[model samples]
Target: MRKPLQHIWALPVLAAGLAVPATAPAQSIDVTLVNGHPSIFLWVKHLTETFIPAVNTALEGTDYAINWSEAYGGSLAAVGGELEAVEVGLAEVAAIPTVFMPTQLPLQNVSYNTPFGPSDPRLVMESVAMLHDTVPGVEESWHEYDAEYLGGGFALDNYVLMTNFPVTSIEDLEGRRIAAPGPAVNWLEGTGAVGVSGNLTTYYNDIQTGVFDGVIVFPTAAAPARLHEVAPYVTITDFGAQYAGTLVANRTWFADQPEAVQNALRDAAAAYTEAYLVEQTDRVAAAMATIASDDDHLHVLAPEERTRWASALPDIAGVWAENANGMGLPGSEVLTAYIDALKAAGADLGRDWSQR
Candidate 1:
């Protein structure tokens, strides 16, 4: 009877020991990503292809897993509504295009205000990332909107002019109407080209309807839009690649996340940046080739002509810095740091925006 009782106790103890090795299921965290534009765009595409997958992989074997919800193509917000969407907690993270939110993110628009710099997307992203990491004002600009900047992503290739007619010199653009997106209207300054505010979605129809004679755009985008069909002449103005926006997360939600989860989001952002640059760089040449093959009229503006176009522009950078300073943001400091970093990186700048 004593042996039987001991065996019964040992059986219960063995059962308890077996249960201890059964680990609890990982916690599931819900994260929603939003973008104003459709996922067809390269940056948005990477969110699904590169960034999200990277995050999932990083979180593997961890105690937490993310269940992602994606809102893109104006499903959650329009072209310029991403910043506000994230701020109000409509989404956990977003790709906020700084060009569209000039009033709210003036400091992040450093690349847009100062153009004709490096054409390489990789170099442009590096310079902007360095500023975000080093410049307190740059990061603070995002904080003001209740979000945190992760990393920068740039569109492919340098900006160019797509026109119905040929442009041999700066004088050619004089008195002609040109459609430029948002602040890019500044690029047409002093060129005599009448700058009309426009975007990619409307570029083709606008030019076809005679609303604007030409458009300032990059190859990767222009080719897909088939702008060459209406505006056959493409002048490589070398306006330089631009750091359009970044991956950002809502401040409140990001703060509440576990440390491991936070690291995964950031690490994934870094990977997204690298993957985007690689694709953007490769796509440039291919896009240019497709355009050249499709359109008979293609011109690479003379080096001297390019220089004149850049030099004739007014001190827009100075005006931008002044405006930012008035808003109590460190515009001048960031501008100086950005130009210096680009120079140190061996960027072939057409103008030293900071010096001016």
Candidate 2:
């Protein structure tokens, strides 16, 4: 559990007026927070509830304040357009999905391709931190875009399969119209599944109207949309977590912040990440249970069937690296560093794509 906001508030206030006040004068920095996801998604919920409040806790005594302007559901920036929005100063802070901007930030997508590498969210989070620390130009990837990478939010985990029709095996998925989010379509390639591009906002309607047999979505979005009611077959492919989402601020604005405010923002980002991770884990279970209780609709793929699907999917790592290289980024090197870190953390060879 997180410490109360009141407790966090007391730190700066207690030191004020002292001979050498416990902390320096509080510094405040104003930033406009933005996101491409809808208001109902877990990522958005985390942004509003856990993130905003946590930052406020960090700034308890600081004069630096976050001017939170939530331009959600792509109101400020369309899906796959956050990079331009930040680079052009339309937004001061953004929670951009690295997958959405693969060409611009290829290094971050390494995790998305390495499926089933690790299920522990804590280890996964640490792997990302380690990769950023060890990889060259990794942090600098953001500099060119005029944004500073604050940190990563929770990995929503490899997507689960939610279908209006039950799909129990790779054979079952053949020729079915599947709704996949951007870049994720690569995973469905060669599965004989017909892929359609769609975002979470349109998922419920699409499924209800039979636009798709099912969609690959995170539990966070599925539960809120009551997708379980429509397409209850939740198949946990566990394809590994995508680099998921990022919490970042405009580099120009971040650079001008007082040290205290910067520290506060950092602290808040970490707090928000941890809390959101826990929340997502809970949502997965709750969503699963709800669908299961509905009986006829909900189904989980058997273990052997899951293995078959995993085997059939393309080796996304090679595709990702090649794509990044084509974009003139250090695609192969960053991928190497990510794989090495996961192995060092005790990841098994079968799940390590670097060696492959």
Candidate number achieving the greatest lDDT relative to the actual structure = 1
Residue-wise lDDT of candidate 1 within 199-237, one digit each (tens)?
777888989999999999988888778888888888888
Residue 104, candidate 2: how far off, in angstroms? 2.1
User: Each candidate's TM vs. the true structure?
Assistant: 0.92, 0.84
Predicted candidate 2 versus true structure: per-residue lDDT over 112-192, tens digit per residue: 676656656666777776677776777788899898888756676546788877766677778999987766776687788
lDDT of each: 0.86, 0.74
Model 2, total clashes: 6
The candidate 1 region of ten consecutive residues with least summed lDDT is 289-298
- Please give the TM-score that candidate 1 achieves against the real structure: 0.92
lDDT of model 2, residue 65: 66
